[model samples]
Structure formats: structure tokens, C-alpha cells
Target: MAVVFDKPTLLQRIAPIFQGFDGPLVFAILLLACAGLMTMYSVGFDHGSRFASHGRNMMLAAGVLFVVSQVPPQRLMALAVPMYVVGVALLLAVFLFGIQKKGAQRWLNVGVVIQPSELMKVAMPLMLAWWFQRREGQLKPLDFVVAGLLLAIPAALILKQPDLGTTLLVVASGLAVIFFAGLSWKLIIPPVLLGMVGVVTLIAMEPQWCAPDVDWRVLHEYQRQRVCTLLDPFKDPLGKGFHIIQGMIAIGSGGVWGKGFMQGTQTHLEFIPERTTDFIFAAFSEEFGLVGTLALMAAFLFLLIRGLIIAMEAPTLFSRLVAAAMTANFFVYAFVNMGMVSGILPVVGVPLPFISYGGTAMVTLGVCLGILMSVAKSKRLMQS
Candidate 1:
């Protein structure tokens, strides 16, 4: 007697690739992606291929997410040091031979024009997580000092590029890792308090400090202008304050319910600057209104909470640290972009995640989601 066996189907072969994915997390991402597409279409309907370009970028990001999610956590850990080193080296190259655009030298032309600082956003967290994982059981004060030095090197380099937005993100991600790795509140509270004091002092002295001939030595002239504008946008309503003023108007005009999709006067009339990019939040607010904005924020909050839960459940220190840091990155992106658009924070060119149209930023967001998925997958597989 002979026995026969049925061959495995293609779905069976591909099933493993999609197995172990976190369902809630995927749902959250889908919600954001759908929101992004709708917002993009409304804002870019007549903006010369922006809608098509955004769709293409999103598809490319989906590919990046799929490829990255397949890699296990251990493999990601292996790539940490190399990624950090290469990222830092590329930033150095940019500082030396980078292309200058609009008074900032942040892009490097290495076969393709790339913003190297974007790379550090992931690398900083990965490197710090890897370091803490290596010193898991026997952490010392000096270990944290070493981690701070590791973080500071790349941060300082990017800050030199004068890209304050990216610098804030990289620093925030790195600091998230440090905070999760058991840094004491005793260590954290002082700097935060001092920062609060500094902000208060600056607001109190705004009129005097913003006067002509006031050269803010620590900040670039444009950066100084941004701070002053944030304090009082009406002072230069037609010049330096145009973006903020327009953003605020669009947001405020979107009363309780939105003006209906594609019916935003401020948006279609061209009052909102960068309507499809940095200030997309304003465009979104205009069309969707306050109700839509709250729903959008709720989606973000859901994703953020799910990510933090994944970090807590991760088996290894590396996975936990990386997950926490990446989760914090999303918070920073959303907070900074919304705050700037609503006139509370200075405009720093940070894009609203998912909704903003930028290829590099979209790809970077994919990588972040991929890492979270990888970490979540690893935990589930270990249990089974």
C-alpha cells in the first residue's frame, strides 16, 4: 500500500508570514492610514499630483513595514550598533559636504539626497536600548553616563545641522529609553523644573528680548524669530507670523462639527500654508471640525496606549526599551505638530504622523510601527 499526501497551499505558505501580528495594533494603524488618505485627497485634489504622490509614498511605506516586521527582535538588536554608527557618520558627512537649502545644511547627496538626521530618530533609541540590554542586571550611574554620552554625540551633530525639529525627536526618543531603563525621578525632575523656569522667564521677558538688535546667541536668527512669533504672531502678521496665524484661523474656524470634507474655506482659499504637509493638521481641522479632530486624536491615543502595553509585555529589556521609545516618538510627533499649529508651541516643521505628506517621514513611521509589531510578535510567539 502506498500513502499520498496533499501539497500545502500558497495561503498556508504565506500564512506564517502574517502570523503573530498584533491585531489591535494593525487596526489602529489602518485607522490612521485611512484618515491620512481621506485628508490627503481633500487637501491635494488640485495641488499637482500631491494626492498621487502621497498614495505612492504610503504604499512604499507599507512595503517597508512588511519587510521589517518579519525580522525577529534579536536580529534587530544585532543591527543597532551598525545603524547608529552609520547614521552618525552620515550626519558628519552632511555637516562637512551636505547640500544647503533655505539656510540649513541638513541634506546629504550620497547618490540620493537624504536627511541623515531622520536616521538618528530610530538609531538613537536602538543604540540606547542595546546598551541597556547589555548592562541589564548590573546597572550603575556610570552606565547611564555612558548612555548619555552615546545619545549626546549624535544629538549634538544633528543640532549642528540646525534641524531643531528632528533634534527634538531624536533627543526625546533617546531620553525615553533612558527614562525607562530605571533612571531616577531625582535625576529627571531637576532639568524639567529648570526648563519650566526658563520658559516662564522667556515669556516674561518676551517684549524686551524680541526687540531689534537682540542677537540670541544660542539660537539661529530664524529660530529666534519663530519663538518671538509664537509669543505674539500679530506683531508680524504678514511676514514671519503668516504660517501660525493661518494655521490658527483654519483650526478655529472649524467649530463643533467640520465644514464638511473639501469645503474648508481657509484651506481651499489658500490661507493655510503647507496645507498638505507640516500644517495638514490645520487643513484637517478645517474640513473635519472639532468633532473630527477629537476623533482623530482618539485614534492616536488608542495606538499610543496599545504600543505602551506592548512595551510592558515584551520579554527582554531591549524589546521593552525599544518599544517604549518608539511609542514615545509618536507622542512627540503628534504633540509638537498640533501644538505648533494651534499657536501654543513654536513652528518647528514636525509633520503630523500619517496625515502629513513626506516620503521620508512616512517611511520612518513605517519603520517605527514595524519595530512595535516585531516586538509584539516576539512576545506572542514565545508564549505559544
Candidate 2:
């Protein structure tokens, strides 16, 4: 017998590969990936490790996006419950046996100092969406209560960890899911009213509440200082106020056209804290100026719009909720970081998405993008 080699048919190989996909989503991913690489290159110009690490992270994120796009919506739905349960369990474990860093216990050492709170940022929405999907087209008041209970537990635990930024993100993610799942305006009114009332009361009672002698049982001292610092950065401009004051100065100094990349006086002089991390936005703004800032905002806006469209077109309820929540989460992250840098909000140390340099945050964002891509692609697959 003569030896023979067989060649595979093109359809046989390509058909299964594109079972689900959204062209717009792939375009968005490529565009953001380029932006991320460009910013990382600028930030890590001399630091080979940072550049190489981000490159690896981008590859890992792309792999995640590819794998998630292949998984069916039903399978993702099935994963929601167990992932949430495990996440909650890990959070509880953090309270009992966790790593204590700078007086906060937010990480667990299971051969790695894993932050359970980060998991909730993604899982909380998935869990809530799964719950809402279970009672689809037949929502009730009790459902909202159950959803609140689901949100409150992990949020409370994370707050106890004193990681306020992550706690807020996780809460916002879960709330977004519930809001999209047909949560009544009637139910939303009370929380909105109460929140407004609470802010008023806090402001009116600021003297007594913020007195150095009187301690607020709820917030840590540092947390309280941060909120107060935001109110009047001039109060302690050299101490707790250093971050906001420096950030505002850097942003203000960057006129319309900016000071040019890596040539920013404040950034080069190291006046801005965490320039490569949480406050990277200020550094970027100082260097790139108004034009670059607006361009970045445009990309984020496009992402949010496409994300909303994908959520609306999602084939399943779980997919829709997850997509919406993830989209909202991204917006919140950007809004909070920018606000903090501009001295509009307290310094809670939230990193600027794609621009800031942090492995964990970058990885988390990549995973979020992957999930969204999965939802969008699945919808496309179903329609075709």
C-alpha cells in the first residue's frame, strides 16, 4: 500500500470555529487592545518587566475572550450559582484566615493571596442575573428583596475588609443587573430618597460626626479622612490632602495641548502619587492634554454604546443582565477614577481602566471584556 496523507476541508475547520461571533465586539477588543498596548509602552518605556507582563496579560485575556465566546449561554448560566457560592465562601474565609496588609484583611492565601472581593465584582452580577432569569417574565417585589439580600451580604463583608472601592464596584454591578431585570421604579424611589436624605444628614451633622474626638462606628479613620479631604483638600494639603491637590495641579497645568508625553513637569518630578497605578489618569492627562483625553473618552463611550446594544440583543436573560452589568461596571470604574483625580470624589484608589498599570485590575478587566464578547457573539450566533 502507498503512503497517503489526508488534508482537512476548510468548512470542516472554519464552521465550528465561528459558531458564535459579533464583528463589532472583535473590533472593539482590537481597538482597546491597541490603546492598552500603547499606554503600557509609554508607561513602561524603560521597565522591561512591566511591558512584558502586560503583553502576557493581554495574551491571557485574548485566550479568555476566545474560550468564553465558544461557551454557550446556558453553560455560563449554569456556572453562575457555583461561582457565586465559592466566591462568598472565599470571602468568609478571608475574615477567618486571610492576609492582613496595611490593617485590612482582603486577601486569602490558598497558595496565592487571592482577593475574593474582586471575584464578587464579576460574580455578583452573574449570580443576580441567574436569579432573575429563574423568575423571568414573572418578577415580583419579593424578588427585589432577595436580590438585595444577595447583594448586601458580600458588599457588607467586603466593606468590613475596608476595601471601599472594590466594595462599591461590586455593589454597583449587582444593582445594575437587578435594575435591568425589570426592577420597578416604585422600588427604586425609596433607596434614592433615603440616600439623598442620608447625605444631607451627614453634611448637616458633619461637625459632630467629623470631630476628632468623636468616632464614627461605621467607617475607618482613614476612610473618614478621605471623604473629608475631598470636601476641603486645603484642610490638610500636606498630609491626607496631598493626593487630590497634586492631581488637580497636574491636570490644571496641562493646558489645552498638554505638556507632551513623558515631558510632564509634575509627572517627571514625581509630584503625583501612584502615577503608574491608580492616579495614572492624571499623568496621562498631563502629558496628552485635552485632545487625547477626549479621544480616550470617545473610545469609552463607543464601548458603552456597543455594550448596551449587545446586551439588548443577547439571546438569553442571563446574558443580557451580565452584559448590562459589565457595561455599567466599566462606566462606574472610569467615572469614579476620573472624579477622584479631578478632586470631585474622595481618593479611593480606583485604577483608570486600560491606562493604569496593575496586573490584577488589568486581568479583571480583560475577563469582563471576554464575558461581554461572549454575550455579543452568542447573540450573533443565535440570530444567524
What is the number of backbone collisions in each predicted candidate, taken in the order shown?
A: 1, 0
Give one digit per residue, the lDDT tens place, for model 2 in 228-271: 77877887899989999999998888878888877788876879
Pairs in steric clash, model 1: 258-289
Summarize candidate 1's per-residue lDDT along 1-384 as a digit string, tens digits: 999999999999999899899999999999999999999999998798998899999999989989988899999999999999999999999999999998899999978898989999999999999999999999999999999999999989988889999999999999999999999999999999999999999999999999989999988888999999999999999999999999999999999898999999999998999999999999999889999999999999999999999999999999999999999999999999999999999999999999999999999999999999999999999998
TM for every model, in the order presented, reads 0.99, 0.93
TM-score of 2: 0.93
* Colliding residue pairs in candidate 2: none
Say which candidate scores most in TM-score.
1
Cα deviation in Å at residue 222, candidate 2? 1.1
Q: Return the lDDT, model 2, position 27.
A: 73
